[model samples]
Target: MEGSNEELNPNAMTAEQTAALFSKLRRRRVSVAEVEADIEAGAPTNDAGRLNLLTYTAWMLKEAGRGE
Candidate 1:
């Protein structure tokens, strides 16, 4: 849900900023499936898609947070 805002300029963000951003997202208590469903589609298993898949899932997990 957090990433539903403006498109991210991954190039413009530092690792710390990204992590902190995700951390904030986690506190929002969104669901992994919610984030997944918001996206047009899931990532493929191809090598090129692996990182993207990981990033998407990580984002979802972040938004979902702990103790869920």
Candidate 2:
């Protein structure tokens, strides 16, 4: 199953690219509080909104070492 999953996305971003993007965000020190503020201020209002919220939370937690 794991092999199948990997095969399904053979062109995915490399670990280095992922690390660099996150590192850039960390250097910027973007706060989860700011993400929350944007959500509360009506950033979006559809599936995209939910996805943005999820992505923001995931990034914050990942930086904090609370994400896998």
Candidate 3:
């Protein structure tokens, strides 16, 4: 089910799209500024400046462990 959803959904998105989708998924307000800040802080993005959701999630999880 998850794989099918993954296949149907676009992997790469602009910061605005990413923020909107993330806000929907998390049921919270995710501002584009926050996403852009993450990118500025070294979150991965493709050459086209679109972020890969999977890659960003992985990077975020890895970063979350840094404080520990």
The models' CA-based lDDT, in order, is: 0.45, 0.42, 0.83
- TM-score of each prediction: 0.26, 0.32, 0.81
Give per-residue CA lDDT, model 2, range 8-64, as digits (tens).
222233333333444565686444455545456543334533323344445555656
* Superior candidate under lDDT, 2 versus 3: 3
Candidate 2 collision pairs = none
Error of 3 at 24 (Å): 0.8
Q: Among all windows of ten consecutive residues in candidate 2, which has the lowest summed lDDT?
A: 1-10
lDDT at 8, model 3: 32
Of candidates 2 and 1, the better by lDDT: 1
Distance from true position, residue 21, model 1, in Å?
0.6
At residue 61, candidate 3 shows an lDDT of 93
Cand. 3 Cα-lDDT:
0.83
Q: Which stretches of candidate 1 lie over 4 Å from their true place?
A: 1-11, 28-68
Off by over 4 Å in 2: 1-26, 45-49, 53-68
Candidate 1, residue 1: lDDT? 24
